[model samples]
Target: MNVTDPKANLAALIKCPSVTPAEGGALGALTEMLSPLGFKVERSTETDENTPDIENLYARLGGEGPHLMFAGHTDVVPVGDEAAWTHPPFAAEIADGQMYGRGAVDMKGGIACFVAAAARYIEKHGKLPGSLSFLITGDEEADAVNGTIKLLERMAKAGETWDACLVGEPTNPDKLGEMIKIGRRGSISGWITVFGTQGHAAYPHLADNPLRGAVQLANALMEVPFDQGTDEFPPTNLEVTSIDTGNAATNVIPAAAKVVFNIRFNDLWTADSVKQEIITRLDKAARTGNLRGERPPVRYEIAWSIRPSHVFLTRDDKLISSLAGAVESVVGERPKLSTTGGTSDARFIKDYCPVVEFGLVGQTMHMVDERVALADLETLTQIYETFIERWFADART
Candidate 1:
């Protein structure tokens, strides 16, 4: 069978419509593409109570020492208004020099480039000296309930392991060789509801306004600095995403106010420590009563999101240096080592092996008509191919 072109592979994937939680034929397409490259592919459908069933792919071309795994997601977020796109979101149309689609860069493009590079390597040099595999998931853009985490757990149960991992997340900010993510900050979300009493605006003595307590609590949460900038990461930051009283009438004082906030914290604090700090802030804020200081003590309930993303850093010389060298050789620029992005599946893969992220420029990811330059696909593939050679060579040493 003729090897599929990387751009073609990406176009095929884009056509799958595998919008998060929807299989959209992305994995099936990948299995078909990898099978021709001598990969032994196995598809697993993972499930949880609330989220939809997700199909994940794990393919290996060889079973040997010092494996290199490429991880990425196939699921793409919904294209807000398809009609608004210059080209059809999933049409995979190539115009001028770019491929236009939803997951083109955020990262079906990454998966395609790596697969193409692996194909070229096998064609030119035969099977890898070690093992070459892919850990592709379909639940990344969603709640992540049945994606990499479950896939990793299942693999561990089945005695699967690897030496290093490179997550194909779009890490570059402005240009293709601008950044490589060496680590990521931890993330946690908190939801709080302050309880008060409902009454007419005229009866200030009878109704305790929850917004008054909420203001104090929010201020306390934002007033204190979580930490200064770490060596690899920036200072911890929090943002209030929402504040809702749900009150419709001008005269009505809602009995409750809900506030939601998320924190992206660095290694200086653990999730437990961060939670404690937040609780402490909330406690102090709760003691602060209404502006008039006449209402009873304010009451509120706090709940943290179930899943907490832990901060991680990778310092593996072989893994980091090889990828950096590859980027420098291909793009003619040394990539900056960074840990400044939001988060990726690398957070989970970090627990298993030393993992870092490098992919195409991410400026257009997740935006309308998300896209990648046609030349970028070829360049990224070359980078991956070079990285593969450097990785296996260094692995032997």
Candidate 2:
């Protein structure tokens, strides 16, 4: 019963085509591995209105203090151009001491390593002192509505609680033990529509050009710094991802212009405050930029994405120090505590418990031939195993 080997466990998970909302038997495979280790596994299917139902796994090995949860998504991103991959994305083929697959690094690999660690711990200790659980979701890559957020909600409704959580989302950028994410910047998107009048290009004076207003609005967002940046986070940045006039004919002035932008903000601002500030900026910019026209003010509409993630920081010295010690002991290097990456499942887990992220180097995640070095797999497994022992000891003390 050496279920604690990453090479076999990860290879099995990568073979599942569990792309986005698809199950591909990944959860079942996880249940099979976890159930043998005295974990009571529950498979839940969650759904949102107009979204596909997603299967999720929640397996717990014990029911005691210092409850530690391991959260990850079994779903993998779509393999873009199968023929371009050196090996089939789902084959889990090992070459040159590396295993190649779609979910090898971005996350199924993390799950496998954690599972291996837990299994090994139980085999050695005869009984795990405190609680250990796995919160595995199948809808992380696409619409996240049916995933961790809902799972946490269900757990809360049932009066379940966790002291802390670790999300396995491939935190390291280039090398193992390089970075550990303690926090992430908040994110929001804005949509703006600028109004104009239709006229011939030859009769430019007769038409109000909305393109000018769109440019001014976009510039208002980009040209100004949102803040000076906080101690744990960088300054906020608003990027204009798209602008469209929708005019096909070279002779006709378009009736409207549209611009879309996203903001990766730090803790200095909330989504609402950022929205208000942006509205103020756009209004001021439009009032000034539209004055050049004789027709009227720049009529426009603005909307925001309904779902927004807020910035969060974990101050749990016990959890941070425990994991850090494990990394140093296993990998021989102290990792950098960073808050530089985009959002992950950690955002949702943070609401329930203090959460941090650490995993394999993510250089190949989502690339053509996503892979994990054979050596890193064993190292990460050792790290997780050591963290489990130290974490329980620290909590008890």
Candidate 3:
């Protein structure tokens, strides 16, 4: 409940090994931390027969116009080989003034700073001028099926709405206040299988090899660039992740060849358009070389898993300007508004309210020896406190 020192709060949070779909007592810890601050906490467990049940928390304080929400995940990615780390990944060790842990930088640090900021704000202002709430989930690092998305649905069903939201994802690339995420690129993945006849490799004329067709398809997919750099985003990209024929013997040709690929695209193309383009290119490649008959070179089937994420840009002047002002006030520089990054939970939160990502520098996130600087922990807490005050102050209009 001591909000003065964010580093201490973060140290406590990073000690919890709350990996994906596992509570690991992280939410319980957070509940205890927030409850004493006058927040009414509610826990919801979402279960799917396919995915492990996830426990989430929704806590709020104050009741008035201009409700502001802070959204983040407590779950962390696996620590991989524990022996590879100098300090235990979940030990929350502080060495050279840096806190080392899996979720130390990628998130838990942000949550701690915000909570500390809220506590400090309450101490100074007596009570928040506007409503404040937290939407915390445990599935951000995993499939995200039973996390914020489900919670938002439930909130809607219960007639709850927010004016704005902030996701505590690490957005700074090199240093605190260097960058804030305003949008994110969409992602789509697919598997392409080119079918052919299986036969002895010794007799080339007798067998139809699918590998040749697959190579051609891959070449075609990568030959043309998806787009030139746009004004707001970089060029779209597609990469072949894997290619397999499952043929163990050199003398035998497999019946089918498969290639898996992923595309990180900008707003220029939609999921439907990208899939159509792949199909068009593959169709052209399939007609290239003839086998034994006068028909097409190979028969093929393309299966696409297009999980579309609509590109969102938050240009809300009040939301952007107030947060930017706060960052300037605390860190002495206004952060750049960027859309460059892999997708995040903000992708889902954007649908409900105008959301931006601002937190610690992420250069160490998801890497070996993930850590956060002790100084940064305090500075981030100051930034969040300033933003909270400015956001509520501006909402009065």
Candidate 4:
């Protein structure tokens, strides 16, 4: 197979239907592509107590210093309403100028392009000044417990290290070379359940409606701003995603109400600090019992999500310049260094090395008809190829 062609590489991958936690032949297809290019490929399956096993791939070409790691995932979100798509979700069918599929842009397309880029670089330049590695995971779209985090730990224990990393998550909003994610906001989620007495709604003072306390607590979290905003990040924002009482009858007040919330915080606070702040706010509001009408402190219990992604920024000047310069060389403009967007596996990669992200436009990620333009695939391949050249040249000096 001609692994240097981005479209062919992507089509082979997209046909695999590798939904979260499933191998689905995606890694096998990747192995076939990389093996011919002289990469020593290895696949490892990660297992945990509660999480399903996940298969991850790590392949390297060359074993020298200043190694570059390209990180991404092959797992895709489920294809919703399969009948609604004009092209089959796993068919990799090209209509007009775009290829339609589940992981086309978020992002089996990125993986394909990077593979093609590395292939093209090797074909033209013989060998890199140092090394290049691919860290691909199959559990990114779902519970990440058995994916990159575990793979990174295992690899590090085997004495593997990287100088810098580029995560190929789709970063462009509308077009290629428009933005590169240099940092990401931290994220945390929690559920608050407020307790009360169950009684008939007709008796005004007979029952304490937990809904009132839930509303007050939810309001307290949203009413106050976490921070004005940071120089490198936006202000911390929290949203009350759900409020449930599970009460159906109009005449009855429920015994408990649950309020679920998630917050995306900026650099001004760490996960611990933000968590503390949330507890403080909830405690203060619970004490008032304003809507409880002089009742005892609102009875409530809080449970946080198991994993809290911490905020980070990449300050590696040479690494940043090499990628930005490549984008400019291909697309005729320097990409914006952005910190917007939800968390990605880059959050985990950051603990190991300085990491940044750039890839295809993200206009249709996870949508019913998720797809990628053929042109964007070719262009991204060129940009990745150029980035490889620039980074290795910079590292040599």
Clashes of each: 0, 0, 0, 0
Range of the 10 consecutive residues with the lowest summed lDDT in candidate 4:
289-298
Instruction: Tell me the alpha-carbon RMSD of every candidate.
Output: 1.2, 1.3, 1.9, 0.9
**Candidate 2: residue pairs that collide:** none
Q: Candidate 4: which stretches are off by over 4 Å?
A: none
Tens-digit lDDT track of model 4 for 1-397: 8988999999999999899878999999999999989999999999999889999999999998789999999999999999999999999999999999999999999999999999999999997789999999999999799999999999999889999999999999989999999999999999999998999999958888999999999999999898998889999999999999999999999999999999999999999999999999999999995775778888899999999999999999989999999999999998999999999999999999999999999999999999999999999999999999999989878
Backbone clash total for model 1 is 0
Candidate numbers sorted by TM-score from highest down: 4, 1, 2, 3
For residues 33-113, write the lDDT of model 2, one tens digit per residue: 999999999999997899999999998878877799999999988999999999999999999999999999989899999
TM-score of every candidate relative to the true structure: 0.98, 0.97, 0.95, 0.99
User: For this target, which candidate reaches the highest lDDT against the unseen true structure?
Assistant: 4
Alpha-carbon shift of residue 167 in model 4 (angstroms): 0.5
What is the lDDT of every predicted structure here?
0.91, 0.90, 0.86, 0.95
lDDT ranking, best first:
4, 1, 2, 3
Model 2's alpha-carbon lDDT is 0.90
lDDT for model 3, please.
Answer: 0.86
Model 1 score (lDDT)? 0.91
Task: Return the TM-score for candidate 3, rounded to 2 decimals.
Answer: 0.95
